[model samples]
Target: MNSTAVSVDRNRTLKMIAREFYHGLTSLLFPAICIVCDQRIDEPNTVVCHNCWSDLKVLSTDIVKMKQIPEQLDTILPVFEFNDTIQKIIHGLKYSGYKSSGVHLGRLMAAQLPQDFLLKDTVLMPVPLHPLKKRERGYNQSMYIARGIAEISGNIIRDNVLNRVKNTVTQTHLDAHERHANMQNAFAVNRSCDLSGIYSIVLIDDVFTTGATMNAAATVLKSRGVASIRGLTVAAPI
Candidate 1:
């Protein structure tokens, strides 16, 4: 009986090893391409080439923390300005089916979070997607970003705590006021969700542009008794 148990454990371990090897090989076969230049990269793990990586301007966390929110936005932070390169990359990730790029950008955003943003009991709640759109996309980009942030901050990701109740139009075309109006009544706390213990959270997203999205999300979280809410994004329009 003991021999059989040992053999089972060994098989499980081998299966895990095999899975890793297969994943590695598959990644190498495709190779990650630079979103900007469309060149095959030597590093299969990162989306941007070495030159593009160096070109990306890492926005200062201090500036973000101290930056004044415009008349409309309550709180906001963007790690990079929205330049042509950034616009191209974000467009590809959001509209062009380059899903892996979300992971890379998420990591960059994670690196820009304030040092103390990940408090002792902080949670990561990404902006939720509408049900139908999420189904079409196969996954939420914000959730992907949250996963990358989770890897670095070691914060618990509570993905299903909030959900989009309305399928709204793209915010790209809306003005600040219209954006807020469009998102009105769009999200709600999950009916069966639990929020009794969480004290703080950092809402993660791919970019911070109009600040409308973050405001709406934070409003919902504040209503749930969360004490502190901060926003983090990979790119901000600045």
Candidate 2:
């Protein structure tokens, strides 16, 4: 073999060894535990253990017809019902810097999607976080979730298609009507983004409470001449 090829193989082996060593050290310092049950996680690359994962109560097959969402969105797909287990997982993803939890949850959500849900030219757009908030958090949780979905569904994620123009207040304490008022004109399409070839858009978020954020994003896309918009969340209150 050529010297260059041998060098590349050696570098690859060193990287693999370094990655394994890091994971091993991290595990020794901080054991992987299930967010919901606080049990030790023996598996690699998993946030929640197998037992807790299996115990999660998923949404019924008729979830679309069961919940009443906003009028602006075409449809909303929720993978699991809002409960203690889901709440802890989402909290870890959003507040505790546990991004791997978001990816795991995103994979679960992707599995719940219909077999042919992603069309040939569909785009996955995550709900945008304001510049200030994003800087504070160091990462956009929704973007991580979108990445996981894209990884599983083989779809494309266009993170720059939309921008959060308004830094709205948190909607946790707000009622449905208040949430609607808070998200008004919060999003705008990027001027440089060309939507000519994009056939559809799927708005992704971590949790759905009032559906205001997703609806507002969809409205912006519609004004930009996008025909179809769907919503996907990891969990929602029934």
Candidate 3:
């Protein structure tokens, strides 16, 4: 066989061996039921069973568009809902140890953005978290989601432009008016930095409930001469 064929064969062989090893390990570690559903996973890697996988209602853009993005905020897109499955997944990522859930949801969110939207000039910016929250959580979930979106979208992620001045309350429980009040004066563009000419931006976050947070961020970016600032999130509580 040629060198390329040999390499392919080697990779296939390694994959088979790895699969067997993974199964063996999981057999010992998770010889019980899946967490997502009552069905037996029989493997540590299988947190969700086939039945639960089917139960996971990945919201359609049509539903997301109708429900989440209000008529006022016209430049946003959401890929899921803050319903049962998404709530669980988001909770796991934000509160629990399942960091991978953020990346997974981020990739899914990025995929929903139009291909033309992710050109070479586009920049991805995640809403900033306060220093206190960052220290407490050890990682910013929005940053992780932005990183994942950047990986697939090939857009440059601007991680430093925006800074959070205060540790605000959870926006989940707030109404539209309360959300606006809560997020007002919360974010500020770094005055020391300059992106004088840069325009197109893809703002990323985990959820879009009232859109006050996104509107606040967009206002800051627009003031700095950003031509277009569009928001993309994993879920929207409509």
By lDDT, the best candidate is 2
Model 3 CA lDDT for position 147: 75
List model 2 lDDT by residue over 1-238, tens digit each: 9999999999999999999999889998999888789899998887788887777677886865677768888888877888888888888888889898888778878887888777767899989899999999999999889988888998899998899999999899999999999999999999998898776999999888779999999998998888889898888876
Clashes of each: 0, 0, 0
Candidate 1 structure, TM-score to reference: 0.78
Candidate 3 wrongly placed segments (more than 4 Å): 1-27, 31-35, 38-74
Model 2 reaches what TM-score against the true structure? 0.86
Taking the tens digit of each residue's C-alpha lDDT, what string does model 1 give over 21-72? 9988977797777878888888755666777756778766675666655333
Q: State which candidate, 2 or 3, has the greater TM-score.
A: 2
Estimated TM-score per prediction? 0.78, 0.86, 0.77
Flag regions of model 1 displaced more than 4 Å. 1-33, 60-74
Q: Native-vs-model 1 lDDT?
A: 0.76
Q: Rate the local accuracy (lDDT) of all candidates.
A: 0.76, 0.87, 0.74
Cα error of candidate 3 at position 23, Å: 9.4
RMSD of every prediction: 5.4, 4.1, 6.1
